[model samples]
Target chain A: MLADQVEKKAPVRRRKEARPQELTTAALSLFVEKGFAATRLDEVAARAGVSKGTLYLYFDSKEALFLAVIREGIVPIIEEGRKLLVAHADDPVRMLREYLFGWWALFGDTELGGVPKLMTSEAQNFPEVAQYYVREVILPGKALMREVLDRGVAKGVFRQTDSELVTHILMAPLLHLALWRHSFAVCCQVPDMDPNAYLESFFDLVLKGLAATPEGGK
Target chain B: MLADQVEKKAPVRRRKEARPQELTTAALSLFVEKGFAATRLDEVAARAGVSKGTLYLYFDSKEALFLAVIREGIVPIIEEGRKLLVAHADDPVRMLREYLFGWWALFGDTELGGVPKLMTSEAQNFPEVAQYYVREVILPGKALMREVLDRGVAKGVFRQTDSELVTHILMAPLLHLALWRHSFAVCCQVPDMDPNAYLESFFDLVLKGLAATPEGGK
Candidate 1:
């Protein structure tokens, strides 16, 4: 009787779990395209092939949906980074490079690339969502970089410097790339930008900058 | 009689010149605060201490006013940078450093700092404005940096690389800083992250990376 009840509930639970993810995914694209104030919940539901009633059942409001989109997108990435950290615990530079490139591959190169652009564009209007994102996503991402920098400094592989500031600096290029792509890239045409080349150059320059070296040796 | 007419005309000409500046200034602040789509021409006129009729006499529409605001803010800075380039033509490195710091002092430290943030947030909604900005402001800014980089390469002070890509890289941090201040700084608070110190660190790392050197050398 217990096994029969468990089997009967499994499909219902699976469908319930999948519905919110589909709604959030649809919402993310719309929000990124139209921005927070302009996007409507009905449109999100329409895009997701669901009724407004269904969307409402999952999310209390558009703000709640926005929060869910951010949370769902970021949490997995942070968990993945944590696993990467453990895997490369002994090599900070390698870990840093892997993490940066891995992030570009997983997030920046995908539809989720809109997240940074969305946050930067809408943060002022939605302070609560912004605060939640900062706490959940930005801070965790920064902390991951900080750990790598700290470990590098401790191991004498990287120069001693303010980890927090360096983390901000390191993240700037990636963030700018995403923001530009989502916002200005529509009209601001640069010939042959090649995102992969851009990231490669960034990694090269940043790692070289962080390398410990004798003063004026070059 | 001629002398009297010329004297009488002088103040009128001055007032004509100043009205547009004042109007643009008001529009810029409002656009920054509320964003382009949300800002009303009436509010902009009221903010500028002018009637709707007077505002319309100067600018045909809000978009026209936005264009004027962008033009008025950036043209002078570009002109100033042009003068700096001429003044520091001989020292590429010094010219680069001075130009970057001077930009921060002039634009980043003023109300004009909001222009970048404004563009990033609203560019998608206003394609024509974004295109004009790219054609007028961004291309010129990139050109200025490219000129500096090309000069450095010619002088053997900097390594041979893609000047365009390098220009984009150099600009990312400054753009990100302005964008952050306008958008996310409220919630993603980092205590003691001095703007000056951040720029200084950026300069240090970037210069180090661009310096032509042997492997493992400073």
Candidate 2:
């Protein structure tokens, strides 16, 4: 009986550890599909194939679950970015390009794409979550971009400019592209506005703008 | 008695003509403050100093009032941009700068700033209204920018590129700035981010990128 109980407990412990992430993944889809205010915890549990009681064991409330979703979605990306930054520290231009595209491949191209739209949409209604996100996710994200820009400027590969403002400028189009895909693209279809093409064009223009000298032997 | 009654009737006709604009202005504030789904028609009427019945006289439903707000907010800006475009047709670079900064002065600096945030937040939930907005506002707006870019490219003042994609790239940062002001700026105070300075920097980098040759004899 003891041996059988130990065997059962091993799987239960593993399942318990995994429950929070599974719940957040399910919650993210629902939150994105049906704005945050409208998504119920019961539905999240149902979508995750867990009971409401199981969800409560992990998250105390709907807001808690929403925060978890955001944190879970972003924290991993930030960690991956840090690793990429270290790997490509020697080449700031390449580092910058890789970082921008890497973000799209990991976050913008995935269901996590909806997080920005979701946060922007519901942030006003949920100030605490907004503040927390800005402090935790946004500031760190900006810091990472700023570091890359600073490195480029230091290397004299990029022009000397305000890294803070430039970071926002660099990010705005990409963020807008993601938000547009999830929001207005439903109504206003510009057939030529492919994400890959847009980002490529954006990077081309931005890199040229930042270069200390004009390309093409100018 | 007949002369007095006629005088009163003249004022009533003028007031009736102004009522729709006044009602939409009030509704715009409420919608921006409280959001679309949460805003009550009766409250909108109260804010406008009119009764619910009077609001219904101009707008059949809350959704109608919301559409009216969008239309009223954007239509004037579009008309003004058209006039600017015609006035500055000779200098595409100056025209682009004027148009970009003019947008910030007129729309981004006003209560109308909230419209982008409001629309982006609610567009998915209100597809018909979004469709109408795209038809009435967005496409025409993009056309104005495209004309500026085309003129620049044709004059060899700017590099040849996909104007459609470039138009969006140009507009995204501007739009994002406005949306950010209304959304995350409430909590995530990036103290260094002065809007005018940000736009100035954006225009500088973008204009530099588009120039047929690098500026400053570099």
Candidate 3:
């Protein structure tokens, strides 16, 4: 009876369960390597060991596949970060450290790092994709950073500043690292910069800069 | 006699004198807008109000034309900044401020600003171009900043730090602004950032971070 029950599970249903993830993982690599416009759906399917028709079953168009790749790859990390934000509400400094390090570990230090370069490179060519990326990824990410800065200011642990502008400053170096990794760093070796050391330097400078001074900060 | 002298200057001499600059100017805009791979030499020529054959007379290839655009547009600025560095050798803070603001004025707030974004976006597609850029522009630019940082540290005006890593930190936001202007900011409106105000914030934060503490600082 157990053998018959196992056999009853349809191969199509089991395959369908795993297909979308496989498709997106394949697409992400191609998009990163070839950039968005140059990456083709058939190649993605071939890389995933699926037929082009099967990739279409999961995604209507290449654009849809791209959106899925981004959403699947990054949205979950952001959601997890949001949850961590609530957990670290009482300690803004700790929250800030975790957030930055967590980003480095999750995005900057991973294969997903290429997404930032891909988006930055292709955004002008595809306004719709850029708009969607800004909405789904950029805005939420900035909002989370803004919250961290706002909490620090409110707690008197950090100097009063423009949270919006400061958030952008905080983001710049991280994005720079990611862009460098995918582009110039591909050809040129920057031997001295261990990414961890670079991040440590960034943290030291930024923390010192943001710390509320004993003499009233300007 | 003046009219006769002017007439004696061949039409070809006059045309040749101005052609390179005009071609570079046109190529710069198109490269910034369409990216390196997509931009055509013919379009650069047409935009410069010259014929395709005339463009070939000055620049043998599109790649050569691009290198000229960068060299013509930016190399002199770097050389000028180098001269100013010697003049400000005694005052590192002033030198730093002047350097940052000078960059903002000359590159960040102008069409040349688009070069950083262009380079970042297409560095992979053209490794030779990227190598030339790094050698010509990036290396000299970083060397100037490193001199400022080294001077500041040696004079005990700024805290001792890794001049190399700190230089990258210093450069990131400026690159961010340029990249943003050419990419997402083209489609997405960030209303709060007046470039001057943003730089002001950056200066404040960085200066504070870099300042040597009264208690014989870290």
Candidates, DockQ: 0.49, 0.52, 0.54
Q: Tell me the spans in candidate 3 whose CA falls farther than 4 Å from its real position.
A: A1-17, A38-42, A50-60, A215-218, B1-14
TM-score of each: 0.87, 0.88, 0.88
Residue lDDT tens for model 2, B56-116: 8888777888888998888778888788768989999899988788888888888988888
Q: What would the TM-score be for candidate 1 when compared with the true structure? A: 0.87
The alpha-carbon deviation from the true structure for residue B199 of candidate 3, after best TM-score superposition, in angstroms, is 0.3
> Residue B101: error of model 1 in Å?
0.8
lDDT of 3: 0.84
lDDT of 1 at B128: 84
Instruction: Give the range of the ten consecutive residues with the poorest summed lDDT in model 3 chain B.
Output: B5-14
Task: List pairs with backbone clashes in candidate 3.
Answer: none
Pairwise DockQ winner, candidates 1 and 2:
2
In model 1, the runs with Cα more than 4 Å from the true position are A1-17, A214-218, B1-18, B51-54, B214-218
Q: Write the per-residue lDDT of candidate 2 for residues A69-166, one digit (tens) a residue.
A: 98888777878877877799999988888878888888798899888888887778778888888888778888889989889888888888888898
TM-score, predicted candidate 2 vs. hidden true structure: 0.88
Q: How good is model 3 by TM-score?
A: 0.88
Candidate 3, residues A11-119: lDDT per residue as tens digits? 6534888899999999888887767655777899989987899888889888888778888898777887788777899999888887788888887888788888777
